[model samples]
Target chain A: MNIIVCIKQVPNTTQVRINPETNTLIREGVESVINPFDTYAIEEGVRIKDKTGGKVTVVTMGPPQAEDALREAISLGCDEAILVSDRKFAGSDTWATSYTLSQTIRKIKDYDIIICGKQASDGDTAQVGPGISAHLDIPQVTYVRKIEEISAGHAKVERLTEEGYEIIESKLPLVITVVKEINEPRMPSLKGKMRAKNAQVLKWNADDIECNVNDIGLNGSPTRVIKIFTPPPRKGGEILKGDTHEVVAKAADLLKNVIIG
Target chain B: MVDYLLTEEQKMIKELCHKIALEKIKPVAAEYDEKEEFPWPIVKILADSDVCGVYIPEQYGGMGAGIMGMAIATEELSWGCGGIALAFAATGLGTFPILLFGNDEQKKKYLPVIASGKKLAAFALTEAEAGSDAGSIKTTAKKDGDYYILNGTKQWITNGGEADIYSVVAITDKTKGARGATAFIVEKGTKGLEFGKKEKKLGIRASATREVIFTDCRVHKDNILSREGMGFIVAMKTFDSSRPGVAAQAVGIAQRALDEATAYAHQRKQFGQAISSFQGIQFMLADMATQVESARALVYSAARMIDAGSKDIAKVSAMCKLLASDTAMKVTTDAVQIFGGYGYMREYPVEKLMRDAKITQIYEGTNQIQRSVIAMNLIKELAKNK
Candidate 1:
């Protein structure tokens, strides 16, 4: 079993602060951390590899600093890591991002499973995982709470739903977007940290993955954010004072007057 | 650019320790302090997390992040609970003698068990007669055939009864004075070895402190660390290497106090405005934050020097410990002042932090001892120049 996990680097929410004057994020002192949801995905991929006896590879798409996320994944028992980074990939929307990731997977050419977090916390857009599956033409499961079982040719999982969960069985070569309920991510062991320190991360740019320049970055993105603003603060409501009967009478009178007006 | 930034690995270690401290240790800290319990649950978490193994070498199944890593972890954990932090930090204190002086066989036999967190280790040098003067400890190890008989007692030994391995200093030759003392690896279950009274302490109650009594305790001759009569050397070397960890603990305590005071000052109100608006309170907070940052800088620099394999680190290590612990004491007291009446109550965190801050000044050689060590080294350096 060869498992590949996709992870993302996001600003630590605890430390993020907004600049009031510019209405933009104050990123100067903010620290970057692996997306909390992606931790579970990495853990699930590593767990599958541990049980089935194969390698776990972690991949991420961002700037050069995103290598930290991949190395962190490697520290948690991933056998290999890849950084898919290029200036061309900047500002790519969910579709373009998924396409780029699928192209990288196609280049790797041998993977039994692809795991990802249901959503990136910063974007809250849960489309990338399913989008990757759509691009790869592989079976995909979203909101997986648990991996019930995985055998030679099939995988069983508990897919979360509004009403409890549903046990879904899918064939091999599947993509899974895991929820936080999947597994607790383990800390890097002493040996694991040393291994991560020495492990070489394979870096792939747009040209390296044979990505089309026309379908990447802001030019390829279909959606654009024209404005971002905080909602207005809520005003206090009027209180109907006095006894219940009197309050009801006054409220009724006000409602009738407003309706008539 | 003279950058004082932590390495990527050090940052990760700090983050891990901070998480564990907040999630695992903080909730239970007050309870343990109130009950004066030994904090076994926290010990279990530290062991399982490989926090206990931070200072050990890689071959022994440890992160081998050295003093800098240990200091970073110590600071973060101490921020949550100084008493609980001591439980983990003391293990490094115990294990350093072995790492610095233990021969191949000893390292192989002892380090793996400790690095795996299978057992705890302790350093016992202080006795009834010896406090700052460690050279006068009365414990004796008399060689007889294949074993050396150890007799006497160790007082105020941290992790005393709970530890499985002990690095004890004892007199091997009465005529040789301090040079006569030797360090030995005495297993906990050895016949005639027993734990004496457990001391009730004012602060850091979660950490265990007790007397270790050895009544004609038998020890294998092979357990001697380095060689005979190297006991003082081992003890001093271990302290030199570990003082930065203690300093880090102080920095953590001070930082915690500063954070609590700042948060409280902003929300607390007087004269229709937050007390934080007052210039008096602002100055106090400014002082607290400055001292905490200064201590952190000194502690990190000393730890980095040790990690860089600097031989002449005694002066800086002692200065770090002295300044940081003093800073902790002052900052915590001022935090209580900032909190006013509420800070006096145990329901709030500042009072607990204040209590915890007092011990950093007293332990790992008192702040007075640290100052002397620093001054003596300074005088010696001046003499060399003359």
Candidate 2:
């Protein structure tokens, strides 16, 4: 079996402070780390690989610096790392981004599974995983709480749900987005780190993957970011204080006002 | 809490330490703990990385790292793998005695290999009867011609069975008690030098421990640290400096506990809402988080003091060690409670965390002794108040 994990590099949320000047998410001078949620994705891919002899490869799409995140994945014992980077891909929406990834995956000779975090910390759109699955036309499972089993032809999983959990099974070459409930990612071993220090990452772009240049990157993207701003700050809820009867009367008046509004 | 005030070089050291811990120490932490296996792989990995006689001057082939830098790195590595980090830092503990007191020949001979990570070192002082009261050591080094014949067992020795060289303290004169204690360097394979069975410990079990038995063990007279009657001070001074590292260990442990608890509270539900949403459980987590931050502050303050070259290392280190370890015990216990029955089970990480946190109070001169040191030092400060 061959498993591929999708990871992203996001600004360290713990250290991220807003920049008042541009109101844009600050990337410059802000330390970047692999998205914490994505760590479980890589761990899941590696786990499946460990259970059934297979190769686990981690892939990320971003600027050149995103390679650091891939190196981190490698350090965590991933067998291979790939950087799907292209200048033209910048500013692409999740749809085009996932489409390009699908094009890239079509080029890879063999892979039985693809996995990723439920959402990127910065975007939190949660569209990429399903978007990729739609493009690839493979079964997709989201919010996997646990991996029930992995076989030669199919894999089983327990996906989280609002009610409880749902057991799902999918054919080989399926896509999965996992939550942190899967498992705590293992720390890198000394030997694995030595391997990561010298490991050669496979870098690919539109030309390398043989995708149409026009339909990839910014040119291929269909969405445009006209403006990005924080939502208005929330005000405190109104306080109703008085005797019980008086408070009830006030609450009734407030409800009437809200209904009219 | 306090600033790592990490200089550029110190920052570089932190990065390297982070890499070693995350890449090397993290994975093996559980395996070594589970098997109680000696962590030579991790020690060698560190020896090959940024560790190994880290505090020695650069002229001696060291990184010229400072105590604060070592403290930061040690805590991080311990956070990743406490047992392995302790094993690696044991080299610094053993060789510091030599660096502080050894002659030029000894410095040239020991520091380079140690700095280069070829040799591992251990410090021997604790005996079965003399732990907290280290001054009452009974291990004797009898002088015979040009050699000193050591005859006694050093108990609870770290890296004892595996160390390449040991900085040992023994009574050269039985009449002087604390004043009679003299320090010496005993190399592995020295005649009459031997090891006993490995100890079964609750925590840091992966770090090898054994009784270093010296039955007529012999070494050259030049191996003595500082001078006769100064061994007690040397040991005390070493503890004073090393206490911050132990406190940092506690800080790391507490930080991990809080992180685990916070993450779990958000996921593990009780009744209708997530446990985190409940006021009762939320307050517990809130207090745990606050304690972790406060403990970190105290530990860091002491580290900054030593980094700033404060005249008295005793009072600050004692305060940090005492507060941090006690906080770790409380936070870890609370973390387990928050985890509920899962916390007590082996399947949950909190149980392991609870087990690991218990030792921070026991080792490094138990928190009780740390309080005594704190009071004694504070009284000294009061006596000199102006």
Scored by lDDT, the top model is 1
Candidate 1's C-alpha runs over 4 A off are A16-32, A62-65, A85-93, A188-199, A205-261, B1-28, B31-54, B57-69, B133-138, B173-176, B194-199, B293-317, B371-386
Residues B177-253 of candidate 1 have per-residue lDDT tens digits of 87998999888999978998779988888988999999999998899998889999899999999999999998998
Q: On a 0 to 1 TM-score scale, where does candidate 1 land against the true structure?
A: 0.83
Model 1 lDDT vs. the true structure?
A: 0.89
CAPRI accuracy category, model 1: acceptable
Worst 10 residues of 2 chain A by lDDT: A186-195
- Stretches of model 2 off by over 4 angstroms after superposition: A1-261, B1-5
lDDT of 1 by residue, A126-148 (tens): 99999999989999999999999
lDDT by residue (B298-344, candidate 2, tens digit) is 77778778767887888889888888889888998998998999888
Model 2 CAPRI rating: incorrect
Per-chain TM-score of chain B, candidate 1?
Answer: 0.97
